[model samples]
Target: MTGRLYNSEQIRDIEQQAIAEMAQGDFVLMQQAASALLGLLKQRWPCRKRLLVYAGAGNNGGDGYLLAAYAQAEGYQVAVKCIGDHALLPKAAQMAKKATEQAEVPLLALSAAFKADVVVDALFGIGLNRPVSGDYASAIEQINQSSCPVLAVDVPSGLCADTGQVLGSAVKASVTLGFIGHKIGLFTADGPDHCGDLLLEPLSIPQRIFAAQEYSARQVNGAQLLAQLQPRCAHFHKGQAGHVVIVGGDFGMAGAPLLSAEAALRCGAGLVTVLTRKEHVPALIARRPECMVHGVEAQQDLHPFFLKASVIVAGPGLGQQFWGQQLLQQVLMQNKPVLLDADALNLLTQQTTPQLKQLILTPHPGEAARLLQCSSKEVQQNRFKAVQALHQQYQATVLLKGNGSLIAGEKDLQLLNAGNPGMASAGMGDLLSGIIAALWAQGLNAETATALGSWLHATAADHLAARFGQRGLLALDLLTEVRTLLNQPCSG
Candidate 1:
């Protein structure tokens, strides 16, 4: 719940420090890990009598060996498959292997076929820096193909603890038990896909040890936003809430700005305005009459509306044409808080603008790549780095949208722990931009607005997905849920 994420190296350093401080030494730490793994196995699979452990030649394999020994002592049918040369194991692993052998546990070869109620993956841990190959790779594939539930130790084998990129292929764990520190990779990119039901046990490390190391990123959820959300007083009027102007909806694309405007209104923006193509104004009002709709054809048309707005949600459907570019120019010229998405972001890539103090840029991988002049693949490879790069380049709060939405500011990096695949549908980003703009207009700082808005958007999507399933989930379906969640108290 602390939501601090560390890289593999940082975790290793913390572990070493913890081990050095403990009187029982490194083996005791290993024993604690084994005990925690055993406890989880017993709690999760009480009736299952068999446990198969896949161990490699490092400390990870040692944990599997120790777990096998403990399971054997507990009277379960335990089998350990050593994937590589047993002689290559480190001293601690050899000690665990010896303990397992002394307990009369069976050590099987990689080719041995065995069925189990549960499988523990200790093949590779956070220290893994190379691609899984040969017997190790084969074992991971077999584990994935098996029906038995898998509990990955520390980290799922073959997953980069720093970037969450799969090294060759990683084990898909039913529950990954992370120790010492939470790895940033487990919450981002491919990490979420491979690590199911992530649980951290910290191995009883003291808080001071963690305090000694800086976390790679912090996580934000709805619970953390509750204190910042104040209940409205009876005397409060609509005018007290700020007005949000959405500038987009060029020509054929009118739905984008409407979505943004509606979201803003739903999130408690006192008044919402839409400035788009002249022809789209009638439909915009018809769809949502609460929104003050204005039709604009020229730069001068938006000037008056721009002056009245407290915050601007730019570039939902703003095309990269002359009109969209002109609108973006006008929004950028304003000193008010701005949330830029879609074409506004695309237009940003075309021109250089002075770094504004109150700005939030929400860019998906492709859009981020465009802004950074890199490939989407590169952007995703290390999302933490990408978000940081964006912040440094723009000197603005950058929200990188993906599996784990990351917000990078001048001082910190935060990740959103909500959202699902159902949000992949169109108009999601526009809705998100609107929510952020609304919160900013309502008096939240740019950073708080970005974090809370991201959480609200994702949490609403999750709630809707739980009801109707992920497929056929529309962006509009989340508007009501967003209102409901915003009114509720924060659980954290």
Candidate 2:
């Protein structure tokens, strides 16, 4: 994660340096790396003894031939299906060719590789920048069609290791063995889908090797955040965490604001207030008397409530009523740090002018598409573009919630790879608003609060879904988990 991220050329530069500095034989390194991949395959798929290796004429194919030899030594039926003529291979690759010949492993054509138990795809690696066509393309398609699992070396062929773009066709790997550093492309765009269950090996390189490199492979892990946190001081009071005002809960949707207020209070926000329709006040107060419920029928009732809020959460179950719109407009006018969700996003689109600052807009794919004036399909196709465009246009931090749960600003973007599929259910977004608001009230700035808060909420749900399963998981399941995360002692 420390080294500068490299494209195909940079990877080649480092590989050459490693070969020279290590003073190891070129064939030895290739054989050793291939043996590691073979070991992983055998350990993971103990029942599979028949292995098919699809190889090209380059070094990637040389590694494949070395693996075929190891598989044969380990008593597995090994076959090296050479995709093209062997005359194009380099000297080191020819050494591998001699080893495969000495071992007497059968060299079959592309089509003949389909019936094996496991397929080792070494046809292409990071060097591929163009489309896969002709026989190689056909062979890749056939390999994908087979039921056997694939173990890809370096990266899935045809997938750009920088931008994660697919080059015409790409290999689908059940497990991709990455060497040296984890490529930044493997975590973004099409990287997640093409490279499955990625396992990185530093290739026995020391940590200092990355100091000379310039790119970044930043990963967001929740445990790291726990260590930097300070515990609650003895002098801390109930109201010390600050008051959070949650605006919304139009008429019949009282439960949304009520849930949000309760979640905030549980997350250590000192005072929680709910500004909702007049009719829903009594039931909310009755359910959670700890929450100070206000019967605000219009914008006039909002100013007094807004004045007491350290953080504001707008538009949870907030219908597009006149009161809802007026209340949101008044809150936006205050310019205090705000968490925008649900109807607040919808209401913003109605504005002809534009958005203001100090705001976090949490929008799903559909909402993101509307804000960008593009189709949802277009947003999904290039989500990084959509999120970046949204942040640039709106000048607000955006949490574009989906599978990867992207958090983007005007200058930076981080994808939260921790959220589970179970979080797709109801009231989840509202709960997220409460979490962000609580963190902001506790003195975290807008960006840190949003990033840390969103990660915590989503990650907590992921942990819960592990126990409850995704089918019936709900937002309320995260309440105790959030409290637990904030209250726990920080870890290194």
Candidate 3:
């Protein structure tokens, strides 16, 4: 599946829908799921004879009980520990208890044997919503303490499946088996820590079921979506591509505009031009002689230059002074496809400007916080909401930059798993802004340009890490990598 992402709530809905459509009883599905879990365990640990299953009072635990029975049937010594009393157990749990008893595996409490070759943690699934406390928390702690390998079902207990945040404390597993659709949380935030090497299974559900759901929460890399753009004709010309113009670069920040302009040129923009402070013009031209660099001390100087450009990337080193604001106001006045970054975003947020659909804003957490009139901590707490809020308020494609940078548009959203810690350094964002502008010039809308550019920038960084350690990777290092990526065969 391509670009399929789902939060905890959506996953629950899918599960319920699948259950409703099933002709068999819920117990049958639980048994099949449990058998699948045991099968995975056998494949993962073929040598392990002793098995431990942690079961709770819910359906998750019912799966655990059935797993124990399957393991026992497979000629392995199995032990089951139910977290709650029999009376408190859910209906599924009761059925599973009967099956387990029929198999002669007596259920015990938390005090059951802990010495096992592998531990199956089926105590909780995606229903977790609170902090781990009391006996459940203690049992989770013990599971982590165990030297044996642990496998988590659905999700690790104590993880917020919606946002990938820790509910308080969560189980650490060596592997996680995700049934049906994979939760979007598993690839972001604390999900990675809880869900180790993830495995997905559809449980034989028909493709029509997924089609009925209409979920678009997940996204793959840009190359997969843009495969048709590759393998340019041998006779392709520069004019057939697109032109990108970047306007920014106040007195001391010429490098910002230059970087953006160069990046746009590298990412298949046919012609690249830079409008910056007059003082930096000569240096920019000298550094990258291929670009048409212009010096603009006043906003009036930008008129003629702006007219000829297909896409405009505004604000890299733009300061928030009257001069910067004047330039920005003029840029906004022009109804062009625009990519805004750095001070441009800050200026827009400060002014509380009305939503503009033709613009894409790439803001770091701090910039996004300022735009939303909230604390950075609040945005970081739930990035999904922040991106959604940005899209709603500005009517623009919003790229919230940070760990697992999120891109949100009118009705779609995606998280980028590319990039590295080294990208936290200065000037990386400017480079990204440039790449997006270039893609915009190449006839992609804000969503496609922003998503593709963001992914390509990060992927290039990953490639850089392969050649040289990530320690000193610079934004300029991405230049060659992007060209190579654009020229390579696109593989889905």
Candidate 4:
């Protein structure tokens, strides 16, 4: 979990260097990887009786062949299937095929439809650069149609190891056992969709081997940020924690700002205020009496609140009309620590302002697309590139939310792997914006607040998803868990 993610070419270079430096042959490394795969399979399916291994014509196929041989020796019924032309296999794979034949394991044709307790996909690998078609596509289709569980070798076949884009079609792996360094693709884009359970096996490569290469990106786990949540002092006062002002909730959109304000309060902000449309005030106060809700019809109405606030959460439920624009302009003028999300992002994209520090922009793919003047598809295609572009353009801490939420700043790029599909509902982003603003108000810097807040928000959603299934999980479901996590001592 601590190593860096490398592209296919970089991983190959690392493997070659490891093999040369350790004097371990390619066959030895293949055997070790095959052993690791076998161990995981046995551990997961102790009573599995049959295994179907679909191998292509590369080192990946060689790993499958070795795994098949080992499974046969372990007294399981093993069948090996070759995709494409078997004669085109590499030297290492040819040796593995020979060993499988020597062991008398049946070699099936690519078109053969068979059933087994488990399917091991070795077709293609991380090096796949083109769309899957012809026999290879047929094999993938067959694997997908099968009811048996599939274990992907190295990476899911046809999945881009660098970008997680599917090459036309990709194998849906029940479990993907990665080797060497972690691939950045496995955690973003279509990666989380195809890779059901991802586990990395380092093949015992020396730590120094990784030191020779640079990491593509690092994941942001909550453990690293827990230290920032120092226990409050015994004599702490509510005013000392800092007040947060939430500006958004246009006409008929009071829930957005209300959610943000409540989240700020739950995250331990000293005091929370909501400045929204006049119509939403009574309902907001009725729902959360602790929040100081104010009805603002003009920029002057927000002046006092803006002056008193330590941080601002902007854009939740804020419309694209003139009222939201005026509020945003005034909020920007205050130069307070700001967490921009929802409609505020849309408004920001429409206007250009001076470079602002102490700003955090949380934009889901669509909002991010508007900010970058690109399509959501493009934003999702290479999220790393898109987030970095946002940070560079706006000079603010950026959190791009999706399957694997990415946080980008001037000096760091982080990925959060915590969240579930249940968080797809509305109000989640509002809650996240509030959490970050609260953290910032609580004296954490912009980058620290963003990193810690994103992790906490997603991890809380995950905890809720575990308790109650992923479906029907509301944004408010995360409040209790968020409070619990913030109060807990840092285990790290």
Q: Against the unseen true structure, what C-alpha lDDT does each candidate score?
A: 0.89, 0.79, 0.81, 0.88
Kindly list the per-residue Cα lDDT of model 2 for residues 1-492, writing each as its tens digit.
532344566566666767777655567678777878888987889999999988887888898998898888889898888876679897888888788888899988766634589988888767777788888888788778779999888788767776566778888889899876776566666777888888877675545556565543245455655544556788988678889999999877888898788888887798999988889988998999999998887788889888878889999988887878888888878857788899888887876534556888999989888888889777765666788788888788888887666777643466666776678888988988898888779887676677777778977887888887877888888889888887676433
Each candidate structure's TM-score, on Cα atoms with residue i matched to residue i, is 0.97, 0.86, 0.89, 0.96
Model 1 residue 214 distance off true place after TM-score fit, in angstroms? 1.2
lDDT: which candidate is best?
1
- Quick one: how many clashes does candidate 3 have? 5
Give the runs in model 3 whose Cα sits over 4 Å from its true position. Answer: 84-86, 102-113, 228-236, 321-323, 354-357, 464-470, 489-492
Better of 2 and 4 by lDDT: 4
Model 4 C-alpha lDDT per residue in residues 1-492, reported as the tens digit of each score = 383667788888888887786654788889999999999999998988799999998889999999999989999899998887889888878989998999999999986656698999999878888899998999899899889999999999989888888889999999999999888888998999898899999886788878877677788867668787777779999898899999999987899999999999999899999998888888999999999988898888888888888998889998989999988888777667888898988899777753556788999999899989999999987888999998988888999999888888865678888888899998999999899999989888887789899888988988888888999999998999998888778335
Distance from true location, Cα of 182 in model 2, Å: 2.4
Error of 2 at 375 (Å): 2.9
Q: Which candidate model has the greater TM-score, 1 or 2?
A: 1
Superposed on all Cα atoms, the candidates' RMSDs to the truth, in angstroms, are 1.8, 3.5, 2.9, 1.9
Task: Name the 10 consecutive residues with the lowest summed lDDT in model 4.
Answer: 349-358
Query: Model 4, 20: alpha-carbon shift in Å?
Result: 1.4
Candidate 2, overall lDDT?
0.79
Better of 1 and 4 by TM-score: 1
